[model samples]
Target: MLDSYYLQDLDEEEKAMHEFNKDWKLSGIQRLFYNSLVKQLGGFGSEAGKFIWPTGVTNTLEGDLAIKDTGNQQIQIFSLDGYHKQTFSYGSESTKHLGDVACTQEGLFLVSDGSKGIKVFSKEGEMIHLLKSSKADWKHSYGLSVLKSNRIAVTDWTDGGKIHIVGVDWRMNAILKTNVIDGLQRPEHVAVTEDEDLLVTEGQLFGRNAGCCVKIIDSERALKKTIGPTYGDHYSFMNPSGICVDTSGNFFVADKGKNNVTLFSRDSSLSELVVTQDLEGPSGITVTKNGLLVVTDCYHHCVKMYKYRQEFIY
Candidate 1:
């Protein structure tokens, strides 16, 4: 059911087209080689294993890094050097998992508790309030993104058909916005831009074409454009679970299936391959004000940093 050699399994006409294109052939070969090496190294064999799992990562405005140890069910804070600065555990024997976390200017943090909805905690990890309760339809509340307007955007993967756009106020009160967008197969991650636009990463679930792509939504939570498909081209994504936009409006996507980070320009005209190596189950992505790219390696239980090589245009 996974898309390991999904591209190679393309129809004859599609295969013939890529066979005649040298660049396409090279890209295919590179993907195959990378996959093989990863398998031999005991990593995920198929694309499905690369994605679908949940992990959270974010960079603080003050240049600190935080990663949720989902496997360990704890939160780990690290300095810019990747040192173990401090870790907060829910309880000694508690298995309550922490999904996504966002830090506010006042050092208050908002974290999602999977199906349990959102939890507000102080800097010392003390519970402040439960923003939203778990509804039977709200299966997996995965990604969280904070906005300058103090509104929190979240992705709920419960029904696997729609995304719930809930607004939260400073008092941690939840407001169910009238804006409920449908047709989302399995919305995994959500990101908000400076312009207040919403970006979501859709993953395949239960025979749906959710994997391998992202979608943009307007301020009204209306579907704007589909970025990629289930497979093919650089535009094609595979189980893309994480998305983040830089200060320049450029979009960075973590293609879990492809084991690479893809970059798209503001106008969607320019698409380029960014990081294609040294990634193990890269689930979440965030960019720092200093232009440093931070990615979460779910299986590896650590976050990796990348320096963006900015290309200036004349």
Candidate 2:
């Protein structure tokens, strides 16, 4: 897609923003001087909220939202209005840092951490069951999504990683090392459509095919299509990691490499890039019913929510 942010035609608003960011890109002593100076003036200032290296975020069962604050080693739940409700903390350490989070149909939360496993918890933050690493190969699992059968899927990007399909209650179902459609290469994040279909973002692909893509599969695990660079502007990904499917079937993906997310239609017929400002290496992402995009940035030490292509009919 043609990014308005980089168009040579350069609109006034775009030029202003471009110039500002160009100046904001400081380093070494310049960065230190800028920070010190900004702090003296009260602060460099923040938009609304700041999250510590947040890696994942998703919509709760009741339509609320949750964020994985990897930098702080905690999971924070917030109301749609931005009110912080609850937080689950893990010890402060990157090796065991939280990676992803998702809400089940029953209102439960499934979270993955750097400890080589997944953990189930109540909405209120009580620990439920720990999905041990022995259950699947995605030790240090990086992605998660609850499938239509109530089953959950997690992805591992280790040497020769694979997607492990577990039961609805979080037990092993199918250990797919091969592909039913396009070879499942280094699956990272996943989302389930209203029809129980699956969409997985491939992270290990490089070069011409560029691992920046997603795979479609049926509820029964049948591969549907490989929606990647071949789909033209409507389909392209650069280090696409995070994803979430909305009620209407359309989904959003965070392309951390490109610092943007692409919204694809239910039928894979259309796409649009969004949230072109203040997103620094965006990783995990999700969309609300009101059409707001909530995402986390690995480099910016914050989480953000904003509006994106909401005019689409469905």
Candidate 3:
């Protein structure tokens, strides 16, 4: 549902005016227009399509999407527009439980599978390397992200949450968890920002501390800011399960309990619900280079795509 009038060819003055009107808080007709602009583009891997317990989703360097189907024990690939592309089957003893997926700039897929640590796969779906932490007792590898430097950041969903930094060596066929950030509650997913800071979704699984939140940790491993537990009076998260950052530094989070996706400004000064409907349990989330928002709904057993950025529309 595009505002085709805005999509029409406009004069330089109109284009400039549209740019000026962009990037602000939406309200009234503007909110309605924003709603229409951010629409469900397409979906794939539904329950009827034979996909079950799809947990993780990430954008590949080739602009495609890679999804981790935990129940089906396979990695499914799709176009940015949600068209079926390819599938990588994995049922080996090592990759018995796939959790989250992240792709490196070199087109390598890093998959998280509990105690098996992380498995590295080539673009052609060949297993290349296995990553395990020698320093810390490896427990569960849940969420994952690839940094600008090609290093990986993944969360451990054990009792004491941990974010492990993994180093890759393709030539040596060696990948190792090099560093660890300790002292998180139950970090479910993680995303690295343009500045190399980490945004981790963590909270207690139950009780009063169940107020799940996203923590912004600096490069030096210091807590910089925390968003949620509650935003204003209308927003409260049950589970902030998945997170991803956009080119503009704004981050989007998929809340499984709330069944919605929320956008947070880079500075953590503002937030808004971008996709508020039709999600049963959105888990893994990723934003493509072109700003397409992809979310995996585990409960609904489908991967949904949406046009997320307003500037991308104007």
TM-score of each: 0.74, 0.74, 0.82
Off by over 4 Å in 3: 1-50, 92-98, 208-211
Clashing pairs in 2: 116-140, 150-168, 205-211
Q: Best by TM-score, which number?
A: 3
Q: Tell me the tens digit of each residue's lDDT in model 2 across 220-281.
A: 67878877754543345667778887656667777776777766667766555555555677
Model 3 clashes, total count: 0
Pairs that collide in candidate 3 are none
Q: Name the TM-score of candidate 2.
A: 0.74
Candidate 2 lDDT for residue 154: 75
Candidate with more favorable, higher lDDT: 1 or 2? 2
Judged by whole-model lDDT over C-alpha atoms, candidate 2 comes out at 0.63
Q: Runs in model 1 with CA error above 4 Å?
A: 1-54, 90-98, 133-137, 172-179, 206-210, 230-235, 311-314
Runs in model 2 deviating more than 4 A are 1-50, 91-98, 133-137, 168-183, 204-210, 233-235, 309-314
